[model samples]
Target: MRNPSRTMLYSAAGIATAFILVVAVNIIAGALYVRGDLTADRVFTLSDSTKKIISEINAPVHIRFYYSKNNPQTPGNIKSFASRVEDLLEEYRMASHGVLKIEKLDPAPYSDAEDSATMEGIESQLLSSGERIYCGMSISCLDKSQNLPFLSPQKENLLEYEITRAIWDVTHDVRKTVGVISALPVLGMNKVQPTAESIASGKFAPPGPWIPFKELEDTYEIRKIPLDAESIGSDINLLLLVQPVGMSAKCMLAVDQYLLRGGRLIVMLDPVSLYSIVKSATDPSYRETVSCNLPAFLNAWGIKFNNNIVVADMTFATRIDMPQTKITYPSILDITSKGINRSNTVTALLEKIGLVFAGFFEFTEGATLKKEVLIHSTADSMPVSSFLANRPEMLVRNFSPSGKVFDMAVILRGDFKTAFPDAGKNLLRKSISSNSAVVLVADTDFLFNDVCVQFSKDQFGRKFYVRKNDNVSFLHNLVGYLSGDNTMINIRGRQTITRPFLRIGALKSKSEQEYKNKILDLEKDLIQTQEKINNLQKENSGRYSKYVFSPEQQTELRKFQEKSVAARKELKNLRKGLYGSIDRIENTLKWLNISLVPAIVIIVGLSWAAAVRRRSSSK
Candidate 1:
């Protein structure tokens, strides 16, 4: 009923006022708040170790972000992936209750604080426009005594572990040390195999990269020795036993004492030595060999190694070229990338890798067991005889794969009393209150040189190929997990190292085979159609001149040409789909985001609105 012009002006004024109020409130809240994003599924996040370390943060964690809001040289480096680094750090603050503090600093071109960030190791690559920008973050606990330089979150799918690990290392008191023992050099593995003469001549040749033990120096302390049972102690946190040959009775007893005292160990024992072709290739009538047995100690702890049976799986079989033009792929004990435990911390961030000549273990009756199958072969796997005298042929068939796979590698956990109850009495050590801890891997070939490597020496006298430890991400995870605190074990989230297939499932083997055959048949048809189109013109070669003159011939040629064009278009679409799944996956991720981010936002808003209404009523 009032003046129209006055009403319009009032409406406009109200909108403007609300905008100002929102901006002012946001600014005030931001001063004391840090922000992070969980929108990315493949974001660089913190590792479980790092997460635990952050959770234990008693003092506030201060973060000063130095970024160029407007980068001149790179034009839009401010929009680069580095911004995600800020988002991740904010996540840490959100998880940290007021203990984590965050601050943002926009350094001017000629500012002293910018120089300080640079001096503190926050590096920035200069761009062409002569504009220098701040591109990283610095975290400090207490003084700069514990400073973390985080430049950018990683751009990989599984980068959270590395980011978190760096944070943990910087935030924690000291890095945990893992103890390693093997016949091979721990790190600095040679690309080329040292001649047998090298080991015999004492030249000290390191093992290859694929030899699972490569790169031990970066993450652990390698205690290279011939371990007898008596040497396990509190000084050693994790013991890695790789193909221990002739471990003296004294050494075995020492190991028993160590486990009895509640120590952890990773044992790799092979059923037979496929380690050296130089060692056994010439024995045409080779028998199976059993390499490692805990004898009595393993049994006492409810862990038993049946060193006699060789595991053969159908799904993950390896193709070995045998002597009789035998290029048949035996369900030859392969524990490739597909075989690793996907949900476990040790095997999560891994791809395809393989193992060979593996053994299996059983828990003795009445043995307390917390068992996890760390590695297994395909469904078409079974046991072959495991003796040096038995020919490898028992497992070697004409690629007749059946889906009979079994566990070649396992992780056994529980309180283990020493095989010799009196063994630890010498040192006067009591069993752990909850009983001591230990780890056992039945197959030594899992870490050997040949099984983990592929080699080709070049004319330039260099040898190189895929490294066995290329698959060692899981191994490193295992090392980090066992030696580390449990809180750190699942800092981010706990995923399995291996996933169990639905053995009793709705999908049968025949259905799987038919599905495969259908795809193959479609591919064949596509190929045949293309070939027919190419030959159509050739089929008319005899009457080339006549056909060129004939109306009927010309009409038929036009039909063929049109049909061929349509077929080509269809083929192109199919090819593009192979590379287009990622886009579809991303779209699906976006659609599913409603299940995560949007829901959180709505809940928070509703709760805030409810609180505001309640306060107004009270007033």
Candidate 2:
């Protein structure tokens, strides 16, 4: 037999040993800066771009993080986000090899810390209870400083990118210049002539620059290039061409020469530009053009863009709810991860992009340039007439899957040959090297402010724009990559924190498709029935009055009514089945979550007890 005192002593010693081991491991981990990130995307792990930026820092950078930790009125979510910010900053500090210093400050009301935070331009969040909280950071490198007024939780995916950009900004001295050439007023209206009636009514106001243009201005110097300019300035770092319509031959040659001389270019073409239509509605002088393209340049480069045709994808159709009915507008695409090329750094982190009446590109035979598609439509896509883009209902009714994938965006890299080979000897005939690149996007309306963002006001009545999707980020990434700021491109728009149930999503999509097909069949039958009724009435025109229906007409009408009722019943059943299936799956998941761990624990406990009993009997 065993002594009870000895058994108690052994148990106590084992517990003590486990506690000591946990403490020692934690201490060693802290000292050695060791961590494990088991997430699939490694969200907690620092990106290679971030590591590279941190490693190159020779000057000491000081980061001051201010949070109202002592304020009881501070929100719980803000506190949690602040903790995450601290952890991320700690990681940065560790990676910087002592060059990055972080100081955490909790500013109380009317304290010196608060005053310091205010001086650094940190924005304070005012609560409903008349209290203020601070959750911002200020980074300084020698004399240069950058302030992030507030760290918004909604922009969590961009947290690392923002921090790295702040560090880079303070260290860098020069800002690159971007040249903008757009048929639309992207840089705001140049001159607004006040009409006599508007002057009397005091209601005339010229539109401002696009939101994306303003965002670009914050990071780079934006130069407006005229459409009729003879040459593109050499000082322009990157050329942004949006809706290149009404450009003279000389201007086209200038753009071609710019590309041939190793200049980076991003062109945005559209089969149907809704923005132009809207502008025409407001400004009578604005000429409305449904399509725009750089035909001369694209044809020479062995890329074909049909300005009269718009891409329609059933798989990526965006559903729009109208006042009368709901429609899945095939012309308006919502490209998801499957369509975005994940291997490309410029588009890897972007989740979704919205495009209106977008076009597609095709590579001609014997194309010499190396081409990579950044975004494409699904196989269930086809080209439709641009004229039908304004009529969503008709477009949906006539849309058919072509079973061919179309390229929406592409990156071409090579030594581009001049489109104007017969031009004067002063211009470049070919690129100096094979490193030049040009990015082409099929749609330009996605960058419009109304399509990509929504207006919102804060508690202090300050206006801000909230992103509707990743369209703005996609543009930023393109600009960053082309301008050789690859570090920021890598870290921007990282993996989303929400892990969706893809299986459930697939099931839902399948069910919705089935229901839609049924509805289409019903509509077709209704149309046929109406046609038959009309034919019968024509045949019996002399035999029956207008109000009184003949036997054959009455029979057809009754049959149509019965079919409509049956369709309604079938639709109801389909909706019920869809919800029922989802509910069943959710319940099963809930049960597993509640019982699985406890069940495993009980089984292990019983197994260990039985083993101990057997060992005791053997002894």
Candidate 3:
């Protein structure tokens, strides 16, 4: 009834047509369409800020991407990451619309590409097989150039920001100026000759510039403003005031005038500066108890910061483990995501920030400025005397939750009126034709190296710092926002791309909490049992011999020992149960992942064959 030859020819034609259609569609997409990023955080998607920066490019910029594609010794992860980097560069080139050119080079062993990479300052990694792999980039525009010597996977979160910043830097010839005013030696103290006693004590080395200050120096022209300065230069883009102590009225007036003239200011006030106390041990001229505030300016600005009060948050306390005891220092806080404002671009991507002896801020009555809290403590936080900050045990013993949140960092934007309005000649009484912004951080010691980073030395004896938290990133974000580099601010410190197993994490946490409670209860029971045994022994010692225990005492001691063993067994069982449950879940997930797709495909295939057979029989 059917012509098999004609049917076969039609089927072949349809298949060929479909294949050609697919090929044409792919070719058109490759030419006209940018690939979509479906990740939850849009990890591969170029952000709007990045697109904006790319659209503003007027001149031709070239990016030389050096990658070791042919090297067998290169790790699989590095190769995958390089592929992603190449895709990202392609996105940039597409977005630039011919303004940005990307040149991908495989610097094989002893090749000319390798020499070019070396000359461009791209760093190479040595493999176990003694082969070097290059994976970095150099950006150039006209006469300007910048090199990222090494592309580290650990810093992938900041990859986009770094690349965008390099592009901006090469295009922009002039660096912005930042003025620093501080009582503390943030710009590094000059080296002093070590005395015989100092050398013997091994505590006389002069410290270099603070890490935050040095980081700023790499990007901006840092000018150290004296504490006694009568005026600030107009050329300064931003003024950074850190731990301002004993400022003269004239200097305060100068700061006031600068703010009133629409200058951006970041003031780091500390209620109790631990860094200052440490420095005082080495330098007698430094204050033993350092507290800084701008009372005059704060009053005029309708903000309140009590220099004598330090904030203590039970929820965000940092734990210190000692040989004798483990104490939670409430004044030293490890601010988590709950404490940061996720809606603000400056702090959105920050994971954790460490602060020592931080204070809190409050708005005064009828405040005119628009206030936003960038970072704050929880409802279980309270203000305590600054002097009690160092006494961790005492603070923990006496801490009372205030049932109210406290602002640790705040931003105020408005037409700010000057605190020195009565001053004569050439001084602004209010912000000139525009609103000004001021960022107030409650602590300065967080920016200090002791709290922010861990110092280390490599095998080559090169000194480096490993950041312990997001303190430096936080500072950089604020500075970038304040200095009108909003593109970098938006791109810096992206959220981590890894998606964790939240359900498993929750289960583990619940198990841990349960175990902790059980341990506490067992310890309490053991303490009571021991006390009873001791009392019985003391009472029976007069009637019986010292070495010989009474029946009641022996029974009590036996019960206590049995209880201790039982507690141990219970804890062991609890741990075993937790692991067993996790393993079971993991195995189920593995099987599901391995078999689900194939099972569905098989079922669909059987269904289609059955339907086809039924139709043929009916025919």
Candidate 4:
């Protein structure tokens, strides 16, 4: 007995209210910068450094992201990556607080956007359907523009860093100048006297400016400072001393004063640099023993340095070719994350760092400077004297592992006192005003090209470099941090996408070790049996007669062969069992991940429904 018109009007009013509320909610969401990141690593979240960089921008910066989205020719992966890029760009816009403006363009063929993209030198890839797809971004500030050309999906880990760095570079107009002070050929010492054979062969160039120097040149201006040079150039933003040897008092004073005056310093001292061996091997006049020391300067900075000792780590030794065969040299340490200082910005994101014939350091008594160790040797590390360290053969013969940790690198930051307090005009400051920092690395060979890069030549005779480690990134991050570009400071080397199960990994390693031991034992037995057979044949051999084996030798051979077959079968079984165990674990994890949550939800829902029915029945 209700009025139909009145009921219909009330229903219409309710529908209208619901629609209005939905529209209002959508508008509010669109206006706000709100996103819930459910990713485990929070990969979509902007880092604090990125947020700071965006917030510090005083001028407007335009970021044009050109992507071919929903195109029939574009790959699905590229489209997905473009969506991620868009999300990141949106995050940046939100963080910038209206300073950053982003524009997304589809740049259709023959369109004005396409023409603009071409003019900006953005690289385009031709799809399988003959349609060219663009997936690059360009950032501009005032008159300065930086183009990424092509944003490679393979380099997604470094995408955020690259974008931030480009924006920083465009906004900041000056490139830092670095001064190099080293006796170990960083500036590529030209031959004072050239040989006639070298001239004829067209290989008569300098020994090297070294590979690390060449890499640094792409970022900073490297000016060579001689040991005899009395003063460091005022224009030098950072001072790098590599394998510094035979430095005079004046040179030491200049360095001390430079650091006191707010100049950044990177000191690399080697107990025995391997590069020096190669350099001196060719020239008799070149010093066979290369060591550097600034005792007074170091003592003043509250650091105790020993140029006569080398750190040898058994747990982290790198295998290298020595004379006739490859052997693991304890003096050549490969420092992993266990040795790296994660709290410091310089070594935080670095994965592996290689050092050759490195030295170790310790803090002196009553030290004033604040010390932070950036690299550490394992508990299985010990120090070897410089004399034994210089000879590679001695390292193989005499080196013994000592279960003790050693400091490989350290950063000291504090107001430092003058090394020569009484010397007038020679001392710059008795006490430095602002807190200055200097990083001390225990090895010089970490910068060597052979250790850090793999040089290759293509079919067309073009040479290119493939980086072997994150050394270059580490160096850049350190230099950038020292130069006050905090945007690049927190950037890690690269993100690793895949994470393994530790329990499974441990099981696999243990099984593999056991299998290896069994194989080695079987191989030893086989070798002994072969030797016995050979001896029997040699003892019975005659010039025109047949080579015969004794019954004992034959019996031993049969036994060894049987043992070998048994070992092979055992190895095969071990491998199969190892894989089976791994597969079972993986399958169990997969099943749990796929069903546990849904099963819990169903159980909870059923329990609630049963409780509600029981309550109704009780009522």
What Cα-based lDDT does every candidate model obtain? 0.55, 0.83, 0.82, 0.76
What lDDT, from 0 to 1, does candidate 1 have? 0.55
Worst 10 residues of 4 by lDDT: 457-466
Instruction: Kindly report which residue stretches of model 2 are placed more than 4 angstroms away from their true locations once superposed.
Output: 1-34, 189-211, 284-289, 320-326, 390-393, 421-433, 453-468, 493-495, 504-513, 521-565, 575-619
Q: Write down the TM-score for model 3.
A: 0.75
- Model 4: per-residue lDDT, tens digit, 134-235? 888999999999888777665677688778877876777778898988877767876567899988998887676666677566456788888778999889
Best by TM-score: 2
lDDT of 1 by residue, 228-339 (tens): 4446556787777766656666777677666666777777676665653334465432222335565766667676667666665545544454562222234344455556
For all predicted structures, in order, the TM-scores are 0.54, 0.83, 0.75, 0.70
Model 4 error, position 565 (Å): 6.2
Model 2 / residue 52 / CA error / Å:
0.5
lDDT tens string, model 2, 67-89? 99888989888889898898899
Q: By TM-score, rank the candidates, best first.
A: 2, 3, 4, 1
Q: What C-alpha RMSD separates each model from the true structure?
A: 11.9, 5.3, 6.4, 7.4
On TM-score, the stronger of 1 and 2 is: 2
Global local distance difference test of model 3 = 0.82
| lDDT-best of 1 and 3 | 3
